[model samples]
Target: MAEENFETGDAGASQTFPQQCSSLRKNGYVCMKNRACKIVEMSTSKTGKHGHAKVHLVGIDLFSGKKHEDICPSTHNMLVPHVKRKDYLLVEIENDGSLSLMEDDGHLKTDLNCPNNELGKEIKDRYENGEVLTLTVMTAMDEEQVVGYKLDNK
Candidate 1:
């Protein structure tokens, strides 16, 4: 069998191999239905005679908060997606609630949605108070989202 290779970073040092459904744990990242999600729960069971053990998984989309579930044989392999978190400085908040962020390397991201959560509210408050805030951007499966934020005291 040809070994499947997975890249974990730009350095090409870290790698991940295919994981069995039965081996996945809650909070672990997995690729299901062509989307990257974080495992929320896992269950396993064996039915009547001649039935193979199956694993049931409940996952939430890492970026979108959407729920997904799947059932597979315990021996089935699942892809584990690579997730990256980046920090960006909040540059502006448009009138429509969209955000503008600047990366440390000077890249600008505009028209990004401010997440609708407590952290999002906090970031907005800080921005309204004229405080500089830095945001945590999460990327997975070619999707990007603002997941967290912190004040930039400098």
Candidate 2:
């Protein structure tokens, strides 16, 4: 199959392709209402006497933890966002408190915003201590955020 390219805020980077609702499973990543969410539960009801069977999907926003649901016929298609987790090295902290990340391949990303969570606080602490750290970046639909971090033993 031909590969599809997705805009990852970069000029021309290839990402994931769309998928059908039936193809998604629990914990799968999907794009709903322009937000990236993780499926928490999924169910299918039997076909009614005069209608098609329905698929019920419940998901939580990956970044906001907000619950969202959608009900559609089994044959309906859904946008499965191309979710990517990339590791970046913390190279600098900008004046505005944003982060400067360097990809494994040495590409610099300067506009990354740190999440407001416990993990985000820990990452900031490590950075202040002059310790090397690796950040896990989650990107979908051209939007990117730091989801996790770890000490860089290297």
Candidate 3:
């Protein structure tokens, strides 16, 4: 793994571009598009005049990881890789908070159990909402992550 580098923005220095990375992992979402981007360090600098804060994101290369000062947004939209959305059902939520989802193929399997303590609140909410039993599936555009939804609607 490459170490995160920190630096100040100097006019003469080289720069890197900002890469759109996943904020969610197993939760849901996919790397629809990917590009090499170098991480740039940013900090708040105050001028004598009061003004709104501004954000500066720098982009860099995938291999060398050299920092650049000037960059333009990617001209092309990123393509998210995905397929058709599938449906599933919620069979049970264990005391452990792990969730089991039933597939259209008649298979009941664990999808994701949040955590034991965290599940009590959700279980109760689901029970009250008439969603005690349900199904869910990953959206086609974001298959990397799973989305829990009602199975009855299907």
User: How many residue pairs clash in all the candidates, one count each?
Assistant: 0, 0, 20
- Score candidate 2 by lDDT: 0.83
The digit string of per-residue lDDT tens for model 1 on 1-154 reads: 9975665336653323488888889999888787889999998998647676888999998877899999888888988887889898999998788998997889798957888888788888989999988899988766888888887788
Score candidate 3 by TM-score against the native: 0.38
Candidate 3 lDDT, 51-98, residue by residue in tens? 433323344432233543332222322223333346556666677667
Estimated TM-score per prediction? Answer: 0.77, 0.83, 0.38
Question: lDDT per model, in order?
Answer: 0.84, 0.83, 0.42
Predictions: Cα RMSD each: 6.0, 4.9, 15.7
lDDT per residue for candidate 2 within 58-130, as digits (tens), equals 9999778899998978777887877878999889876676998997778899888777788878887888899
Residue 131, candidate 3: Cα error in Å is 4.7
Q: List the candidate 2 regions with Cα displacement exceeding 4 Å.
A: 1-18
TM-score of 2: 0.83
- What's the best-to-worst order under lDDT? 1, 2, 3
